[model samples]
Target: MPEDVEDPMDYIRLHLLEKLQVLLTTAALLAVVYFGLGRWFRPADPLGPIALLPGGELGKLLGIVVVLLVLAAVAAAATTRSRPEGALMTALFGLGGVAMLSPPMQTLFWSYPASMQSLYLQMMAEVLIFAVGIMLAEGLGGLVRSFMAKICPRWLWTNTLSELSDQQRKTLKKSRIDPMWDKNILNGDSLSVSSGVRNTLLWNLLSLSLHGKNRTAAQKQVFRGQLHRGFGCLFSGVLAGIVLLVLLLQSPERGQILFALFGSFVLAALFAHHLFPVRTFFVAWMIPMLTAVLFYALAAISGTGNRPQYQVLPIDWLTGGAGGAILGFWLSGRWREIRIFEALAQAPPE
Candidate 1:
């Protein structure tokens, strides 16, 4: 009866359309991640004969990855959508441009491709990674915050909260911290540790403080942008990276001896952020770590004598995992930070 109310058929139609949009977007993104990573790491099977670094295509694969990410960033600039959507849209177009330049996907569309058993199994494991990471980021982040507050020294929190710059104060306002409770964390209830929610606030404030304290003015500006971007936004980029990796392994051109060396990044949002950074990086390392373990376990379970002639050895995985995870986490975080700054910079100055 009112202008605000919609007809039932109209609602059904719109809901269907929305579902269709999600379906198309998911497929497109799945294509982009799968094809992009496949083409990049063509030379190294990680599970097959090609191998990874030290003896394989790790360096070359990595070099190409940096180039493609830059390409992705450039492509993202062309998208009018918001941050995460822009990133995905960029990947879609970036994959197209890549395919045009190199139609190497022919061999992959082989009529009789290698057995997908290993890859499928790997995919299952990856699904686990995403399930754990995506589902837990909110809960685990809060939990870890509480855990940190419960264990961390009161002095550290007091010191961090005590010297809140105007920007820091604004950040709290932006985060919607309760004024009264914020005051408690800052100056009240000195002896009693804050409850979980309050402790969560303390941990985030502490994160902001720790990350921004020694930064240069420009860097601090970026850090403030990161604070505004918030951990969830930063984690979205991390989510995109892991999603890319998960899709990477599902390519039609596959062998059991597989490695998504290109997409290896902080699998961290799965467990936890920046200490936080380290924890996040550790999770990123899980991409490769899980890949390595899953394959080895699969091999053992199958009792296959066709052991992989790994060019990328365990050491390569460990070091690559460490570097890639940390770097990926930092880069994704930085991208979100810069993007937030770009948006904020356009607003009328305070």
Candidate 2:
């Protein structure tokens, strides 16, 4: 027999065993990232809710068992021992560990008094479970990605704007003569249009230009043009004052709501690049900022509605006022220019 040749079935078995070992390693790494990052940044949080489980100790014991099982499985596949006594023993230990780590096993052992040993066991168990879960998910995700690559339509993921509707596609095409959308929004000293609609459209255009891939120089130019045209303020003072009031009175418990509100506005403003020819970045950003302020105000007035409240008055007002004033001035200037432009357009061109 050739030195390198092995039975086909045997080789297949070995490969499978090797794959499992690799999976074990991957699980270990992922658990570390998830738990370690969370701990380092925010120590107050107990290592994921999993750490709180009753069978925490058993989980750690099971992790050790899994390691042994993987080793034995690999050994059995590599060597031609009829009994494979050591392999089976290792496998048993691993399985025993798994059982200990299981939720049911932990529940059964709930009567065990808490101690340093118990705490260590729980932490270990949570880490093991997390690692294994992430490894399994990663393995499945790889399969999904491969399937998507093979099965998904190319047009759906491609960057070519020719796929859009005629109106949208026109914004994508290069033109010597500027479209009405571009001319109206982009011909200003500050590089933005005052109209909410125009700003919104420009924002979308920029986003499309940035989608899923790098933009060509031409695409970048288009994006820049739209950005310049769409950058302006809308309702200046009234919006500013309202925003300031809300920030001054926002409560801590409503942080999530505030975060969501601000996050959405920022995201919309960013996406305004995709909706070209409309100048809506300022307006889009304003939407979220306004929402955050309003949410804060509501939460404060309602006493966080069954949640703890944090005092944030002078600081909130100062920050909100500064931001609002800048935004207000820009919007007021843009609004004035837009009106003037409209008036000039109505008059006969000199």
lDDT of 1 at 107: 28
For model 2 the local lDDT of residue 254 reads 31
- Please identify model 1 stretches exceeding 4 Å from their true place: 1-259, 264-280, 305-312, 343-350
**Which candidate leads the pack in lDDT?**
1
Q: Runs in model 2 with CA error above 4 Å?
A: 1-36, 43-156, 163-224, 233-249, 254-350
Error of 1 at 102 (Å): 27
TM-score of each: 0.29, 0.23
Error of 1 at 237 (Å): 10
Q: What is the TM-score of candidate 2?
A: 0.23
